[model samples]
Target: MCGIVTAVASQDVVPVLIEGLRKLEYRGYDSAGLAVLNGGLRRVRSTGRVAELAEAAAEVHAPVGIAHTRWATHGAPSERNAHPHVSGGLAVVHNGIIENFESIRARLSAAGYVFESETDTEAIAHLIQSKLREAGSLFEAVRLATAELTGAYAIGVLHETEPECAVVARRGSPLLLGIGEHGVYAASDTAALLQVTRNIVYLEDGDIAELTREDVRITDSAGQPVERATHVSSLSADAVELGIYRHYMQKEIFEQPQALANTLEIIGGGGLPIPQLFGADGPAVLGGVRQVLILACGTSYHSGLVARYWLESIAGIPCTVEIASEYRYRSSVPDPATLVIAISQSGETADTLAALKHATLLGMTRTLAICNVPESAIVREAALRFITRAGPEIGVASTKAFTTQLAALAVLTLTLARMSGHIAEDVEARHLAGLRHLPVAVQKVLELEPQIEQWAQRFAMKHHALFLGRGRHWPIAMEGALKLKEISYIHAEAYAAGELKHGPLALVDEDMPVIAVAPADELLEKLKSNLQEVRARGGELYVFADAGSEIPETDGVHILHMPEHYGMLSPVLHVIPLQLLSYHAALVKGTDVDKPRNLAKSVTVE
Candidate 1:
């Protein structure tokens, strides 16, 4: 959840550190800080935005520095809890939790080391400083200190004594080394370092790196030297910029069409779905998959829920979807014939990765990953993977990532259905045609943003909302509700239309606005009855209807017609207006649309 950037350069690096923090703002931070070695250690921290920290550090400049944007974990968001925690001559910025910090704190406290802030990172700084007497250099001290710590962490350490070098270590959190002409840098994400370098070295789980202006040295956990290949990054600096959009959320919402097209580009030539689309061993793995168990968290979990409907209906396979965090703790029946699928936008999701490992522990080896990042931990762990080309989604509330995930899952569904001999050639052709036309459909749906924004203006005034859908679209409704609550700060919930009269009908009133996904599918009449139930209760309605749904706008019911009914792929299109609605509602309310409260883009900690 936190961000770390460190550099050892021939020139002053304070401005570079601040700029890197600005690029990492999407990771959702409450405090920003930086420490540099300019003859002595100089540190500045702020509990506000990075710009505030930059303003405060305007006079400080150095050739070696480390910076951090922190999302609160061990303590409250305050200047005292900000990173670049210093002890002795060392300053540290950490990205993940230290599980055994209490013990380490007690030990360090017994040695008469005072803790300035209530943070796990301060313990790390003290621990590294304590090792300075026994270790030869700052890198050695950091490596020794990390051996005693137990938990996920990607830490950057700077020592005033070693003015020309910075040390960084990673275990369970992401960290990368960047090679630039004038400097060597390290960051938790490539976006933070893209301004300085295009060449990157992705460190392994226990790798420790020492960066200097001239070169970088790497060592494994056991102290042996190692070599890591540097790859040229495909991401451009302009890709992360919010071009004409007011916020990154709005920009990502509009980018969904291209994102989906890129994800589904494999089958653009119009052919039967093949297993190799997943990976080289996809054929061997898909052949033995008689049942499916999908594991994911957040929006990715909802995608799995949607996939359950597809797998059972089209592929004729029994499917179950589980929340990854919960599934990892509880015991469950594991079948050898079951395929375990893990879905995540960033495959580094802590819970999802743990759940995948848990599944492997249970002897379920038929693993697959549907993720956006190709080099993520989950993708590397799984036997098969389908990487969605959603590019980099900077917003905390997912838009393009969700749609790209659905596009990838659709391809997975068709492949399995074909393997099971459950699809006719003509039926496959029709589905392929729908997928080929999906980008156009998504663009047409984006055209309804103006109408959705008008609806959002009304929603901004309301505090509660209820979303309704049926069948596969039920998951889409859940995703919509999630988006609204994520960015707008509105309390929202979703229900399968059939479950309305069971208990949710009692909550429907004039104060609560009910939104419905009214696609003209087989369940249209049943969903129409559910809408009528809301109308009977004086609940104001906002319905997104298909073009031919014939759901007319009356006194209490507001209808925004979608461009078309996209058959099995309707969820991909139905979700766009909901995303726009959330973006506009957050905009109207003046909330931070990209970095919502108490949320992080990539959850690296449990």
Candidate 2:
């Protein structure tokens, strides 16, 4: 939920570390602070953004520095609770909750350790100072300080006594080292590190690193040297470039076509032209699994919800989608006959990692991940991982990841459907052919941006929106409504087309805009009847349908006839229009599309 950036350079490093933290600000933070080893020890902290903290440190220039952006876990977000806490000679910044902090604090207080802040991170700096005073080196002090600490944590320390090097460690939270030509940099996520260097060393659990300008060394608690491998981030340097779009969210909204296309190629590329990203193991597992359980949080959870519909409809298998935070709390049945699929964008979400761990502890037949980050904690746990190739999404409200996940899930659905005899040989071939065409279909929907812009104007004036669909498309409706409420700051609701009469009918009126996913399928007549119910009640409508669906020519209905159907994969293509609708509507209302109020990009807090 927070960002940590550190550097040991021959030149001033405070400015660079603070800039990297700004790039990671979209992850959400409440306060900022930095510790610099100048002529003497200097620390600046504030209950505001990185820029505010930088203003307070304008006079300090240090060659070695470490900074923190806090999300306020242990205490209220105040200057006192901000990170980069210091003892007499040791300064530390930390991520993740320290479960046993109070007990350790009580013990230290009796021994004459005085604390200046109410933060759990402050205790660690004092602990390190006490340990080093007792004849311990920097590494040994960190090891001893971490010995009694419980729960998830990642810590970075800079000592005034030893100003040449910075020490870092991770047990549960995420951290990576960016090895650059001039010096080294470290941060909580790949974004902060990518600005300086693409070659990164991902620190796994129980791993620690001691970084200096001359060399980078990593070791375990047992003192055995460990090899640090370099993995490129999921995004390229060009990915962050918004190009011609007005905002990051707008750029990602249009990039979905190429992103989904990239995902389909990666997932479907066995021996095909598109480079094979998923290994032989992915197809093998999908061909053999008897049962499946999916886990995720927030937007990823909604994707899982949509995936369940496709799995049951196309694969003819029973699938359950569970929220990651609650999955670990339940006693679930798992055996060698079951398959667990965990989805995450960052791959370091605490709840998702805990749930994935719980599933493995019960001995699931096989564990897998569909993640964007290749070296994330969840990906490390998966026996096999199918990476979603959607580039970096800087917008706090996700746009590309959601669509790419749907595209990947669609591939998984069809591949399993062929093996289970739910689809015939020729039908499977046809579906695979449609997967290849998904990119173009999504592009066609994106080209209708002007039409969506017009619709957004009408939607911007309304206070509420309703999304309706039937059968497999119900989840799409739910996801569509969620996108609007998430970023557009509009009251939106989704309901099954058949359930419109049960309760939602009361809300129907001329000012209310109802979005209907009316595809040209066997259920077309029933869906048309459902639209008539809305029309009879004087509700305005914006309908997305496959060509030849024979949409009713109602006066208030605005219909966008989509390209040809892609079978069960059609929903993936169909959702593009709804997302664009929400994006444009939010932009029209002058709301913050990238960082919506009260919503964090990564739900790392809970």
Candidate 3:
């Protein structure tokens, strides 16, 4: 998905628009452009970062304009395909795709509309221009144009005839209105306007709003006036600052303790979670749930896999984990009593949202979302929600977000256990105490960075790496491999320690590095034998072992001891070093740790 920002302000709004686009660069960074209604819609665009567009638009004097940083969808990433697509007097910037654009473009072409850019967004501009020529209001023209479209979109449009007014609309995509002292703004996300204003109104599906410096008027698809509640954002501009860390990933890794502490705040002054943590209907949903189906993608999917272990072992509930992208395409048996949980950091993940809706369509009405953003689509769509407090994860490869998801899932596990009569009070109390001490344990885990860095130095030189673990820690190994491949650009794979000789051992050699996660659990001896198999084959071992495991370092074998054995919460603590290893390896290889190539922070489009 792309990022869009539009404003109808009292002062010269170009500077504010540029700053907003800068903040939204994490959403998309291929190319950027801005259009101001100065002397009949003057515009500047670049096939570069937003900074280049800011430099090009330095002289824009109009107080009304729209801007976009595009992640290419219907065309190549070039200056010609950059957003703020213009036709006649209409300029449009869009986030989602126009699925029926080919048909619409052919019709418009026959009607004597000349297109300049290879973009679905350009078709919208021409369509709007055609409607505006019918002698109707701007809002009416946009409404008529949107009725013919067939896909997801959050669009901002500005017409030269009415320079002081801007119109924005959303359908199956996110758009928020920022009410500020000097102007009203529309953006794909709230982070764009956090610096300028904290008052936000999230537009619902099929809603359109016309904005000006003095007023905003929202209406539904039927042209009926609709009331939208305004919310004051608690996120200050400073929370997003890098603040001494070399990269946001590094900063977020260090922020894990704080994030987890905030996430665990719901279990305050008591051994059990606060009744309101899951919402008003939480108890009924958890108490009535016959099973659980978790839908997620990427890092969230790995977190869901870990939660499967917790749900089955601790909560005594049957649980299944599914990748959102694949789940939507397959026909699965749905049980109405099942609790469908969707895990997403942005909560706007396209496939995950589709899968949740698919489940709902199949008579699975009981749903919950463990999301980071409170106002995300997944939160609104689900019947219940748990908001993780990991704020502003700007890294393309997730760090704090993954750890916080695990923390929230643990809370869910304990709550479900209490509801299901599977856990005793003493066991629940012990788990609560363990959760309380989790942040401190994670902080101590951060102390292993220098040791992990020494290991990363060796890893940076290897082209392929093997990550090994078993049981609950198996998902942690998958996450470790994901982080390494995502940031460091290394080819890494994960396998269960017991599955080494099954097939993967054939690939282990002197050139391959095998990373093992051995926490002194019941399977420690079995894992030791697996490591020996690798060592016998001349595979260098980089082992992260707990103190009780007593795994020694000899010749080709290297060991970094963990602080302590964290029992049930070992996955949460064990993931920290893998994050550090990935970060350090990427740093040593001179990779872009924050914005990895070919990846966006949020996968809002499939």
- Give the Å shift of residue 505 in candidate 1: 1.1
Name the 10 consecutive residues with the lowest summed lDDT in model 1: 268-277
State the lDDT of candidate 3 residue by residue for 71-177, as single tens digits.
88888899889988988788899988889999999999999999888889899999988898683889988888888888888999999889889999998888999
Each candidate: what lDDT?
Answer: 0.92, 0.82, 0.91
Runs in model 3 lying further than 4 Å from the true structure? none
Residue pairs with backbone atoms closer than 3 Å in model 2 (clashes): none
Can you write out model 2's per-residue Cα lDDT over 444-465, one digit (the tens) per residue?
7788878878888887868899
Better of 2 and 3 by TM-score: 3
How many Å off is the CA of 523 in candidate 3? 1.6
What is the RMSD, in Å, between candidate 2 and the native fold over all Cα? 2.7
Give residue 156's error in model 1 in angstroms.
0.3
Candidate 1 global TM-score: 0.98
Q: In candidate 3, residue 593 scores what lDDT?
A: 90
lDDT of 3 at 571: 96
